[model samples]
Target: VVKYGKWLVAAGAVGMNVLAARDHNRAEDVFGALEARCSDDPRLCDLGDGGAYLDPGTEALYQQSVGYDRRARRWLIGGETALLGAAAMFVWELTRKTHRPDNIPFEPEVRSLRNATGVGLRLSF
Candidate 1:
């Protein structure tokens, strides 16, 4: 089985990185504020370093808002677990060659019970 492949990874990355939804933006504004404060005289920017910056470079507040979302998405697919599963698949062999290598092989015990004829749907949060 091809588990936790491209579809899961891309969906997770795109949704979390862009964060184009309205509700998430509103929540960010409620919890976080823009660095728009120019404390010294309204003409100078308060760089949060106790020093007044004459012309602080412009940076979008939305950039900061997406930082944690990116982390959350990268971890959504359980990458480490998938890595371990792949390692285990390549590490073990279920069918040993007792007869000629070209002889018909029986299905592995685990797969015989775990799989079915109909389509199977998988979903996770």
Candidate 2:
């Protein structure tokens, strides 16, 4: 998860998905999925033909995500708040570097708790 966050930060800083994902595995996963689908026998399922569509879509989406990550770096969390948090973390780390204290970034907190409420949607036949 921390690795993902770091990747997102790089993407945000670089401001280009094609450039950012140049070092990311998301594109590899896209290609692997497309390859698997293309290689599958038609008797089993029809997959190869639509894969081209997915490729462009995946590229577009990855590019967009890169842009999003880049923009996230500009998040204006109150400087005072962030400074206080960083200060607290510095002191806390003095005690235990790996200790999880509280209010960790990206972990669910008050406002984000709304997102933790309703489950994600899924489709099933």
Candidate 3:
């Protein structure tokens, strides 16, 4: 059960990371577009009081870029959390003790015959 939980957590981490990567890519694309627009229109680059006043179209693009950037950050945080969960599960598994039936013991034997010689393991329950 712990093994399965570890696998599930690992898979979730991978999935979250994939989503984060996708969102990050989208954010980069939007940022590029925003830069291009600012370059084409010097007025869009003007910043007063720490914020530039933008036209409706430019404002829409800026909002879109902000949204993507925010989403990417959220996905990245989720991915990191999932990764930590997976690591914890791995540590738990490593620290766990193996349980075997007390009545069963491993017995190793050496066998010899006219034409063959081999080693065998015997277990009795």
Candidate 4:
């Protein structure tokens, strides 16, 4: 059970790491696209007024991309948390001690009990 648990935890950690990497990559892609668009068009820059001007329909696309990037960031955080938890669990399971009766050095001894003499076992680690 311990071995299986460790394996599962390790797998979960790896999976979460992969997910986080993918999300990070996606966010980078979106940022790259935004940069590319801005570079390709000079008008995409901020105007002199407080309100910046964007191409027709381009503003909605940019907004949607930003929203997607934000969502990806959230997923990345979740994946990181999961990965950390799984890694800790894996370490805990791997480092846990198991008790084996055969491994213990138990010796038979004569002992005096209350109102009786009896044979007893003494254990030594």
Residue lDDT tens for model 2, 1-125: 44244444444444443444443454455455545654663232232564423345444544555554444333422333444555555555456637565654344323335456443443333
Model 1 misplaced stretches (Cα beyond 4 Å): 1-77, 94-99, 103-125
Model number with the top lDDT: 3
lDDT of 2 at 79: 31
Stretch of 10 with least lDDT, candidate 1 = 103-112
lDDT for each residue of candidate 1 in 1-125, tens digit (9 for 90 to 100): 33444345445445544443443555366335544343334554434564434444312433444664455445544454444555554444333234545443443332334556444444333
lDDT accuracy of residue 22 in candidate 1: 42
Residue pairs clashing, model 4 = none
Instruction: Show where candidate 3 strays beyond 4 Å.
Output: 48-50, 101-125
Give lDDT per model, in order.
0.45, 0.45, 0.81, 0.66
The lowest-lDDT stretch of 10 consecutive residues in candidate 2 is 72-81
Give a tens-digit lDDT track for model 4, residues 10-102: 576567567656766766676677677778886774444545445644464466667666766666676667667667776887688867658
TM-score of 3: 0.73
- lDDT by residue (39-120, candidate 3, tens digit) is 8987876655757444666777777878887887888888889889889989998998979657758878998978999889
Q: Which pairs, if any, clash in model 2?
A: 12-70
Residue pairs in candidate 3 whose N, alpha carbon or C atoms collide under 3 angstroms:
none
Candidate achieving the largest TM-score:
3
In model 4, state the lDDT of residue 5: 66
Off by over 4 Å in 2: 1-54, 76-125
